[model samples]
Target: MKHALLGASKAAQWINCPPSARLQESVPEDPSEYAEEGTVAHALAEIKLRRRLTLCDSKQRKALDAEYEKIKTNPFYGPEMEQAVQEYVELVEIRVMAAKARSSDAVVLLEEHLDYSDWVEEGFGTGDVVLIADGVLEVIDLKYGKGVPVSAYNNPQPRLYGLGAWAGYNYLYSIDEVYMTIIQPRLDSVSTDIMPIADLLEWAESVVKPAAVLAFAGEGDYCAGDHCRWCKVKGNCRARADENMKALAYEFKDPALMDLEEIGSILFITEQLKVWAKDVEDYASGQAMKGNPIPQWKLVEGRSNRSISDKDAAIAALRATELGTDKFLKPEELLGIGELEKRLGKKEFAALLGTWIVKPPGKPTLAPETDTRPAMNSVENDFANTDMED
Candidate 1:
């Protein structure tokens, strides 16, 4: 279990690490079999959609058969491929129906690698779907994550894919506007957003360039926290050591012992530690700036509060339910000390109270014992009498 956890951590690390760093650190393992499965599912969906658009008799079964044949020999496909293929076929059918109902055109690109640059220095990605209808292009990406639906807005990967699609189709034919969509069949939802060419270029310049630089330099810092629990190098990272020490100290030590004096001392030292850590991080950043190959580190925050527009409506609806307001008793409505005594009788209530009010564990109450003065030794008097006798 430990080894598996470690392997998973390394996999996650590799994903965020820059390509150059990945090349340096042997060949980072490809994403898990599940990721491959998702790709197969996406590929099948694209193939099915393409057949439906091109063929006059585009029966669902025919499309499914073609998809199955395409994936049969692939080493990536496993036992779960059958189920994934079934889901993909159903999703494609649903999408086709929706497009037909809306009187919209749907086109799919099968294994189409859209290259933006002639030299292909950096700009290129395979687009799964490039839908052209009503004089607008919609780039749709398929995701298989069961969590929250993937959003295309502000997502670099999808945007890059969109750029590739734009370059490919525009160079071939012509396009005025482009819309990006991320469809998560597992979640049964599609998130759509739009980006202008100019905006996308700006994103590439401002975001992608910097990320690429850091990744190329292999200067990503060791960010140790809750995330370190899943980091590949957690066992060896100094930051992890510091974190573990702090955690253990907090857990075992008495809270009362962490008085103002101790807290103040820690706070003072913490500032110094922060400065030193930042200095190291800045050194790495400098190396990245110098074009030294390094892994990439992105600053990601914890989950933020979600905005709920219908909060009041939700509360009102909950109150209307049988297991809501009627089932809950107000805190103030509960019996008080005096009332309890009256109901249960003084003796019973006293006994209950004795059990209820818990006493804390006793503390050491030892006092110092002292002697007022030293006593003369009996041996000295015995020696004086013995000398007289001699």
Candidate 2:
């Protein structure tokens, strides 16, 4: 009953691992707080943008306001969440303005449902923001996740959204170029990829359509890559295991014995192996919990930390018994410098405490030459030179 495996958000995964679309059906789609938080953030962004544009009807405005209020009441709502949504709103506003500037007749569409069934079978998705001008179309997506920095270059999600937007608006607008932008405000990453209308359509027809057909029919390769991270079947995926195990076949006794490419291959395989091992462990644990224990394996209680069940009452009782507060709880102390900086704005805190600050050179460490940090002086040579100078 699990659906949305072929959703635009997951186009990259199914397009690459075609079999994953069907395989995902067997696994339960576990709810994620991060996802829920993102939903709330998106709702907030929609409300703010709609209000700014004065595009909302009275009823729609009231409903959105209610939804916004309800979401703000969630425990996850905080200053950071508000700020991130605001950042997305500002970026959309800027892009909309830029689009209109190019041509007075330019139109900005919000949360528009786009049908891409022209190339993909019954394919459709909503573009967060779509800007159509004289000869250009811009599809803007707001990515609420901060864990990974998403890029628009060859990124399937934005591309799919772009295609959907184009399919819906191409008839009205003489759109020659398509611009896809992924705005990840949390990570401060905004990446855009521009493609000609002809090329974008060609790629969709040649690449996406075929892949989607195979994926929907549960017939295609299970090519594994970074896209496998969020796949439901990843833990028990045989193809993933087989692919990772290919590294073990290489019997290089030591890393130094391998060439540049071999070493790189080993490194990539090692990382995949780590993921595979973790997946196996999680799958086993889950099975055991469901009374379907693995051979010679049984679930055991994990170590737990002690806690004060009734801290306030216990503390009161202790105080009544003439026990000092220090016996149970430490005296209140001033916040650490780091905490103070957070309490006061960073700039104000720095200005106040700047004179007292001292920064020591960090210890030398090994890193690839491509690292942005400057390499430290050689320890032995630096000490020797210091001694001679002294």
TM-score, every prediction: 0.45, 0.85
The number of clashing residue pairs in each candidate reads 9, 0
Clashing pairs in 1: 216-293, 216-294, 217-292, 217-293, 217-294, 218-293, 218-294, 218-295, 219-294
lDDT of 1 at 332: 56
lDDT tens digits, residue span 257-368, model 1: 6776566556555654564455456546545666774577643464989876887786677777777564643445758765665455445666768678556745533222
Cand. 2 TM to true fold? 0.85
As a whole number from 0 to 100, the lDDT of residue 149 in candidate 2 is: 72
Which window of ten consecutive residues has the lowest lDDT sum in model 2? 338-347
Best by TM-score: 2
What is candidate 2's lDDT per residue for 255-369, written digit by digit as tens? 5666876766676667668988998898889888889989988889999999989989988888888776778887898787766654553456668898987888777765556
